[model samples]
Target chain A: MYIVVAYDVSEDHVRNKVAETLAAYGLQRIQRSVFAGRLPPALVKELAEKLRRVTRGANADVIIIRVDKRALDTAVRIGPALPREGNVHLH
Target chain B: MYIVVAYDVSEDHVRNKVAETLAAYGLQRIQRSVFAGRLPPALVKELAEKLRRVTRGANADVIIIRVDKRALDTAVRIGPALPREGNVHLH
Candidate 1:
């Protein structure tokens, strides 16, 4: 499954720490404060637990998104059909 | 740009309302509680504003993920090269 996790961290230190942990798990930083990756269910559970521990009391809002296998396939197949300009492609 | 919005709704009624609004904006529901879509920056801001109003005090965590044009293009271009079976593709 493809999962995208986004969080709003109140403290920069805590954000960096959490980002480090996620990077260790092979998550890619895709935006200013968002991360994306593909992981199995067990890995997701583990990552969520670690994140909860590290982000406790940091005043952060975390959202974990799971995109199923089917949607991912649809996206990949349709993506190439979309217009491409510079480096922008929509799937 | 490709954007994914995921939220945890405390109440079922509010969740449905918010989902309805998102669908009206061309966002496709890929999971039970997650929606995916492509939108411009202005549309994203407008959607965020409307989501805040509809989900006020509903005890939900909403995360908006923005994937840059370059990353999106990369994903699209590489997605087909990955393994494919049973409607699952990764980029």
Candidate 2:
């Protein structure tokens, strides 16, 4: 299943660290602080746990959202229609 | 512009109340606790502020995400490709 993880991290260092960890697990960056990827249940659980540990005492709030299959399909179809460049058209 | 609002409300009553307020302003429900709609900046700000007030002391956290035009288009295109029925395909 695809997971869309978002975090409101108060510290930039922690955010980068979390992103790096996610990248090691093959997650792709979708936005400034959002990452997306497909993973098995085990991996999802492991990653979530690891993230929580990494943010411990950092005063960061992380939210990992699981996207339903329907939403993932919708995102894929609509993602391409978005402008490929410029902040005005990108989000 | 389109705003995609998501809330993780701990109290069911607060969640429903917030949703009702958003519905009054023309937001359409996209998921169990997520709503999407197009509106002017003034309206979006007003809605967000009002939601904060309604959720005060309710032990709930509300997040109002502003989707770029590109993301909005992506959602629109992919939304149709999603399964029309069943939770398996709907998110």
Instruction: Provide interface RMSD per model, one decimal.
Output: 14.4, 14.3
The local distance difference test score of model 1 is 0.59
Q: Alpha carbon lDDT of residue B30, candidate 1?
A: 47
- What digit string (tens of lDDT, one per residue) describes model 1 on residues A1-91? 5766656667798878778977888877644455667887789778878887887777655556564434333332111122431121112
lDDT of 2 by residue, B1-91 (tens): 5665666666789878988987998987665556667889888778867886888777655545555444443331111223432122112
Model 1 residue pairs with clashes: none
True interface contacts reproduced by each model, as a fraction? 0.00, 0.00
Second chain TM-score for model 1:
0.73
Lowest summed lDDT window (length 10), candidate 1 chain A: A77-86
DockQ, candidate 2, vs. native dimer: 0.05
- Write down the lDDT of every candidate, Cα atoms only: 0.59, 0.60
Docking class of 1: incorrect
What tens digits encode model 2's per-residue C-alpha lDDT throughout A1-91?
6665655566789878888887887877655555667778789878877886787777555445554444443341111222431112112
| Model 1 residue A79 CA deviation in Å | 32
Docking verdict class for candidate 2: incorrect
Cand. 1 TM to true fold: 0.44
